[model samples]
Target: MDVTQVLRMKGGDGDYSYFNNSLLPRKVISMTKPIIEDALTNLYCDMNFPKTLIMADLGCSSGPNTLFVASELVKSIDKIRLELGNYDEPPEIQMYLNDLPNNDFNTIFHLVPNFQEKLKKQTTPNSSSPRCYISGVPGSFYSRLFLRKSIHFVYSSYSLMWLSQVPEMISTNKGNIYMSRTSPPSVIKAYQEQFQRDFTTFLKCRADEIVRGGRMVLTILGRQSDDPCSKECCYVWDLLATSLNDMVVEGLIEEEKVDSFNIPQYTPSPKEVSTEVEKEGSFMIDCVEVSKVNWDASTDHNVILFEEEVQGYNMGKCMRAVAEPLVLSHFGESVIEEVFERYTNNIKISMSKEKTELVNVTVSMTRNR
Candidate 1:
């Protein structure tokens, strides 16, 4: 396969959605849902929504957290339905859940019944009669997935940053690619270019999918506007890189490959996205707030289980999300364990250093009416 194609394999292994679930405390989740609902409310005009208005989670992975998003949607739907007091005619809320083909649908399917039940309880006769119709649409977000103007809202959590592939330059230089994430700047630059292209296309696609009055709330990684030094500024990448270095010193991996690696250019500032949203003339800025989404999975208090799951074996999984295609060569598969632990520990240290720092940013906006 081409180098770019290989790089996409990086995301298949350790999805952030899978881990973010355990990390977010109940109180934090409680606070976050309102912000999302408020955005959706503004977009849909206070849940005076359609009888068959559609809401799609663009990158709905196979994790329990998917329901958290679903529940949030239902919360707004129910609240609005009660206020509207149309017991005879409730709006039809169709929930379209999507993700990459490789995502675990078995897990996703298992959650559907419970998700439906929860909505049913919150939804009175005044809510949409058919209730929220939940279904899975498995495909790439880069392409069109819905019928024309058939959608009212779209939400993609932590998914837009994945590029279609590694750069062709890396594909052409596969044999000589860096093993270290920080080993070379050229590889990093190539990946960043791909991210920009991918993001532009994503905005365009979403712009097309939603009606002029429709809205989309996209949550992805971002850097501070003032962080002039883009290189290695991300806490996640820094932690991962340091871990990889320890593995290299222990003779677990080749130094050149580890040094050449870097995080994908997924994290963009609010200003950057706001510029594109306006440039496309597709969406108007409803809210563009930046805050850290990083949460510490306490291994010290929770047990070794949290530690092991975060990085012990999943470090490479996280790295491959952006590194696999960028680094064509390999340094034996056996050393991956050591690589994983160091990778996870670095994150642990970083998280420990800052308990309430703003790390994850979500920018919510609406299609121009």
Candidate 2:
């Protein structure tokens, strides 16, 4: 199956939608706020505070989080302008929100009026605010999405770990939907090579579009261990595979169906990311930092645990929001609820024994002259 054609977060603001379950991503954005603000400040000062600033949020999936990012950008720049006493002439801002065509752009568009009104209220009475123009650009970021040297800054969060497609050799990966401890050496090698190729293509495309000295900040799902199958990186998928296997044992789904499924996602190490950036040679790495967030970080810790079920259920809902579309496309709709049900139970058992965390890698870079 072509991943680009089918891959997208579950849309709309419904209970199971990514729009509602994206607290984890919102946490990621908050964790990286200092990095983002630093990058924007450097760009503003380095460009001598240009009267017009052009930026884009790549893979900006729909919801409040979508405009939440835009709002952050506007506020950061406004703070810089306020510090510099440039209230009389705030720069005009052109912000592009890009995602796959399958993403719910309509939901985002409907929220723009409210976003603008909030910005208006936030502006001080006598101070001028940046006149911001927001537009949606629907397409894959792996390909060229902007004019040459036209963009000033770029940001993406909780995206980029997804490959353009599953590796051609991945069909040999049986009994697993992602890299796991049991995956053969060949399967692991194929995933690594695919990420190298895809990440390089991404850098080359962006190098051509971002002007010299323009900056990009990316927060990707990543692992700290050099071992690709480390528990922190692959345990979630292992639990998911076990869930499918249980259904297979019950004859609810064919064994071959589970054998054929694999996610088009890879979590690279910091070394892997820096290696690609150095090889691509278009951008200077300002910094690469790793952070760990608990699977239940968004949930209330005050909740009394009835045998630790809440954390598992919350994680199950979060994973479902992110993975349901891909799973639905592959297995059809009938098994969605049952599979996640089993998956949630497996998580409850595992979380009882140990805490599970997601490792995120945040990279800040600037285009070389």
Candidate 3:
């Protein structure tokens, strides 16, 4: 499948839209705020606080999370200026929101006016907020999206795990949609090699665009273990594969279709990420952190439910918002609701036995001269 043509979150603010179901990503943004602030502060100081700042938020899906980074950066810079006694001369910002061509850019554009007004309200009477110029750039981040040496900083969250395309030789990865304990050795090797190639290309492209000493911060779903079949990385897909297999048995879908489909995502280990960065040789890794978030993280943690049904339903909706387009394109609209319904039941049963969590990795880097 041509992933660029199909990979996108469910659009709009409807019941199943990404905008309503993106609490997990929003939580991630909050969790990494310190790292993002540090990177921006260092970039601003190192660049001597340029009068104009240019930056991009890669894979900025249509949601409030799209502008969360921009807001944070502005607040950080404003605080820095206040401390340095330069609040009177606020910098101008050129912000780019980037994603695949199919993303819901209209929803994001509609929010811009309110975003600007919020910024205005935050400024003190004695000082003015920076004038932020926001524009949408539709494309894949695996390729160049900015002029050479033009960007001052870059940020992406929960995006890089998606390979540009599925591995060419994974046809033998039957019965599974991602790396699994039952998958053949060749399937695992194909995935690892694919990630190395795509990640290297990503660094090379960004190196050409970001100026020397520019900062970049990325967060992705990742595994702590070097083993590709580790539960942290592959278990969720396993559950999804199980859901499809159940449908196949009930004659709801063809086994052949299930055998041919594979998700175009890979959760690399921290070591894997460092290896690619070092091998690519364009950026230096400044910080790497690994954290665990419950699959039902968006729900209130203080409320302990005796029943797992609510948690399962929450997770099911979240995954559907992100994966529905891909599934819909492959299996047709008929199977979308049934497949997710089965997936939710599977999650409920599994959680009844034991809770599951996702492993997230955050990396901070700087463009080298």
Deviation in angstroms for 211 in model 3? 0.4
For candidate 3, list the clashing residue pairs, or say none.
none
lDDT tens readout by residue for model 2, 32-121: 999999999999989987999999999999988999999999989999878877666788999999998998899899999999999888
Cα-based TM-score, every candidate: 0.76, 0.96, 0.96
Best by lDDT: 2
**What's the count of clashing pairs in each model shown?**
27, 0, 0
Q: Comparing 1 and 3 by lDDT, which wins?
A: 3
State how far residue 158 of model 2 sits from its true place (Å): 1.1
Instruction: Give each prediction's root-mean-square deviation over alpha carbons.
Output: 5.2, 1.8, 1.8
Q: What digit string (tens of lDDT, one per residue) describes model 3 on residues 4-106?
A: 9999999999878888788778888888889988888888889887899998999999988887777887888788767767655899999999999999999
Cα deviation of 274, candidate 3, in Å: 0.8
Q: Write the per-residue lDDT of candidate 1 for residues 218-308, one digit (tens) a residue.
A: 7765567533235323545555566666666787667777544433345666776777677777777777776553343212235445553
Q: Tell me model 1's lDDT, rounded to 2 decimals.
A: 0.59
Candidate 1, residue 153: lDDT: 86
Worst 10 residues of 3 by lDDT: 298-307
Q: How much is 74 displaced in model 1, in angstroms?
A: 1.6
